[model samples]
Target: MRAHHRSRLLAATAAVCALSVALAGCSGTTKKDSKDDAKEKAQNAKADPDAPLKKGLKIAFLPKQINNPYFTVVDKAGIKGIKEFGGKGKEVGPSDPKASSQVSYINTLTQQRQNAILLAANDPNAVCGPLKQAMKQDVKVVSFDSDAGKDCRHVFVNQAGSDRLARQMVQDLSRQIDDKGEIAILSATQNATNQNTWIKIMKDELKKPRYKDVKLVKTAYGDDDDQKSFQETQGLLKAYPKLKGIISPTTVGGAAAARYVSGSKYKGKVVLGGLGTPNQMRKFVKDGTVKEFLLWDAQHLGYLAAYAGAALASGQITGKQGETFKAGKLGKYKVGKDGEVVLGPPTVFTKKNIDKYDF
Candidate 1:
C-alpha cells in the first residue's frame, strides 16, 4: 500500500508540474513577466515594512487555546526565538478553542500596537475580520499550525506539507489494519483549518486504488478537550462495531483517544495513530494500544514561525514566494507559493524509537 501510494503521488506531482509549464507556455507570457507580476502583487499587499526589522520589535503569539500542553510547549519555543532575535514576545489566548475566542485577543494586540501577531487560527474565516483590521493597523500577522484566510495573514508557517501529513496518516492506518476495513477520524475541531485540510486530503487519499478496501466510517470532532475527546472516541467505537483503526491528528485528541482505547475493550483490537508528543503517548505505545504515529517538532515549528513574523515586521520579506529568512538554530527557510513556510517532514514514532523524543 505504501509503495502504491508513493508511486501515485509521484505521478500526480509530475502531472501537476507538467500542467504548470503548459499553462505558462499557453499564456504567452515570459518567465520574466510572471516574476514581475508576482512582485507587483507582493508590493500591493498591505502592511509590509519599508525596511527589515533589525531590533526592538514586539511580537505576540496566540494559539488556538491557552494553557494547552501542546501550544504551551510551542509558544515557549516561540518566545525563545523572539528573544534570540532581540524582540519582545508575549503569549496570550483563550482557554477554549472556539472560533470566536481569538477575536478579543487580536483586537487587544492591535490596540497595543504590536509589531507582529503570530497566531494559530481556530477557524479559517472567523478571525479574518480582526486579522484584517490588524493588518490595516500595520500589525504583521503570521499564522502557524492553523491558518486564517489568505487575505488576512501575511504568511503561514506550516508544520508540515498538508498532502504529506494526510497521506502519512492514511498509510499508517492502512498498515495497522492490513489495508482493509473501517476507519474513522477523531479530529480537533470541525472549523480548525489544519484539521479540515488534512481531513479533506485523507478523504481524497481514500479514493485511490490502493485504499479501495479501506472505508472511512465517520469523522468526529472533540473540540480539543481531553474529556470530550475521550467521550467522542467512546462514541465512535460504540457506533462502529467494525472499526479497524482510528486517526486523531491533534495532540490533545490523539492522546485522549489513546487513553480511552487503552482502558476500554478496544485496547488490543483497534489500532490508533496520529499526531502526538512522546511524553503523552509513551504509555500507550508501551502497552501496545498504538503501533505508530507521526508528528513534527512543535518547538521547531514555533521557532520558525517567530522568525517569519520578525521578517515580515522588519520588511525583510513581504510574504512573497522565494523570499528567504534565517531561523535561529533551524537554518534558512524560503516561502513557497501562497506565503507558506514548511518546517519539514513529520517524524514517525513507534515503540522502538518513541523513547528518544521528549516533546
Candidate 2:
C-alpha cells in the first residue's frame, strides 16, 4: 500500500511539472508577441501618418556658391540642424552662382533618389525644370536665401518678407545718411530676385516724403563678383563725385565696396553701408569707411532652412498654409499662405553690436 501511494505521488508531481512548463512556455510566447507588437507600433508612430515612410530620410542642401562664407556658414548650420532634427544631408553648390552649374548638381542628386532638395537657387527659372522633374519623381524641393520658381519649390525660407527687408535696407542707410544724400547701389546680378526685389522696395521707400532728399544716382551690378563690385564702386565715385554714400546688398559686393572706398581717395568722403557679414565689415566699420551694415544671423538662416526642409521631408508640416513647426535653435515658425518661412527681422550690425557677434 505504501509503494502504491509513492507511485501515485510521483504521477501527480509529474503532471504538475508538465503543467508548469506548459504555462511558462505560453507566457514566454505571449511576452514575445507583445514585445514585437509594441516595437511595430512604435515604428509606425515614428512614420508619417499622413505621408507614410518619411522618417530617417535624406535631403540635399544646394547653396548658390559652396566656398562663399555666407553659404559656408549656412552649410555648417544645416548639418547641425539636420543632426539635431533627425535627417541626413550634405551641402553642395556651384563654384559660382550659375543656374547651369546647379542644374547638374540637381540632376545627379535626383538620380540618386534623394528625398528632397533644399536650394538657394542661383537662377530663378533655370532651376524650374530640374526641380519640377524631381517633384515628378516624388522628390521634394525647398528654397532658401534665394527663391526659385514658386511652383517648383514646396516652400521658401525667406530671411524676411520681401518688402520688409527691402524697406529696412533703405531705411537703415537713410538713418546714417540723415535721410538725404546721393547714394549709389552696388547690387548683385540684375537677375537676382532678392536683389531686384530689395531694390524696388528701396526705390519705393526712397520716393516717400521722409526720404525725398535721398537721391539714388546709379545702380550697378557686380554679378556677385568681387572685382566687378570693386570696379563698380570706383565708377560710382567717378561718375558721382557728389556721392555721399553707397549701398551694396550682396555680401561679397558689400565687402568689396567697403575695401575699395577704404583704400581710395574717397575714404571717409563717402559712407558705405549695406548687407554684409559683421566679420568682413569689421575693419571697414572701425575705420569709418562703413558706419554700419545690416544682416540676419546667416548661420541661423541655414539652421532654419534645414529645419524647414526636414519638416517637409517628415511631413511634420506640409507646404500648406498656417502650418507651424519647431526649428530647434531657431524656435517655431509658422508658414504663411504662400508656404514660405520668414525668418526674423534684420539685425543691424553697428559699432556697439558688431563686436558681440563672431560670425
Candidate 3:
C-alpha cells in the first residue's frame, strides 16, 4: 500500500486576535497547564481486559470532518469494526474540521447514550469540557487519526508514532530537495495539535548532520481549506522565489499544494510531498507534481479505535499504560504512555506503488 494522510489542530484567526486584544482579560493557557492535573487523575483508573464487551454498545466515530475523504475512509472503517462486535455505530461530524464544530456532536452523542465516542480532535483542548462531561456519564472516549489531550480521552489511536512520522517527512522532503535548499511548511491550522507536533519534530529532524544545508523559510497555515491551501502555496512561492520545496502535512493542504504547483511554472522545479491519501495523491504522483508522501493505514486506525472504545466501555480496560485488548480480526494491541495506541509507520507512495492501494 502507498502513503496515506491526516489533518491538523487549532488556529487563532485575525478576528479572534482582534477580539482578544480588545478584551485584555483573555488568558493564555498552554496545553499542559490546563490538562496535566486532570490527566494524572484520569490515568489512575485501572484496566480489566478479562471482562466481556457489553451487548448493544453504541459507538460513535466523530472524525475531524465527516465529509473529508480521509476521515470518510477512517470513520467508515470504524463503523464496520463496530458492527463486527455487535455494537451499533455511526459517523457524525461537521462539514468543516474545527474544534467548535465538534462540541455539539459530543453533547448529542452523550445525550443519545453512546457507550463510546471515537474522536479526531481538531484541537487538543477545545472540546475538553464536553469530553470530560461525557466521561462523567460513563461514555468511553477514544480519539483516533488525530488526538485529544490525554486527560480528555480514554485512548488515542495515533496513525503512527510522532517521532517516526516526523523523521519520515523530513527525510522525504530532504531527499527530494537533495538536502540543500530553502523549504517551507503548508500546514492545516496554526494551532492544530497533530500539525504542530509533526512540524516541531520535523524542525528538530532538520538539525541533524545529514540535513545541515536544508533551511526552513516559513510555515504557513491553510485552515485546512482547499482554496486557502492553493493560495498559500502560491503565496509561499511568490514570497520566496528561491524556495526549493514545500511540505504540506495535511491531506487538504497537500493535495491543494500539488494542484497549484502542477499548473504553475514551478511544477517540476519545486518539490512537494507530505501526508496524502492514495486516491487524492495518485494523480499528482502520476503527473510528477509529487514524488512521494507518507501515511499509515487509515482503515486500520479507525477499526482499532472502535475495538479500543469497546474495550473501555465494557469494563475490559481503562486507558492505562501496558493494558492490552484484542481488536477482532486485527489482533491485540497494548496501551502506551499517555494512553496512546500507535498503529504503525506510514508508507511511501510514488508512481511505482501508488496504484497498489485505494483508500
Quote each prediction's TM-score.
0.86, 0.83, 0.87
Residues 40-128 of candidate 2 have per-residue lDDT tens digits of 33223332324433456787889888877777887788877777756777887788875477999899888988877888887887887
What lDDT would candidate 2 get against the real structure? 0.79
Tens digit per residue, CA lDDT, model 3, 4-88: 2221112345456567665452457333454345445556766678888887899998988877888889988888998888999
lDDT of 1 by residue, 44-83 (tens): 7654434555798899999999968999889999999999
Error of 1 at 336 (Å): 0.5
Candidate 1 lDDT at 353 equals: 99
Find the 10 residues in a row with the least total lDDT in model 1: 33-42
Runs in model 1 with CA error above 4 Å? 1-42, 45-53
Considering every candidate listed, which one attains the maximal TM-score? Answer: 3
Give the Å error, residue 96, model 1. 0.4
Clashing pairs in model 2?
Answer: none
lDDT of each: 0.88, 0.79, 0.87
Q: How should the candidates be ordered by TM-score, best one leading?
A: 3, 1, 2
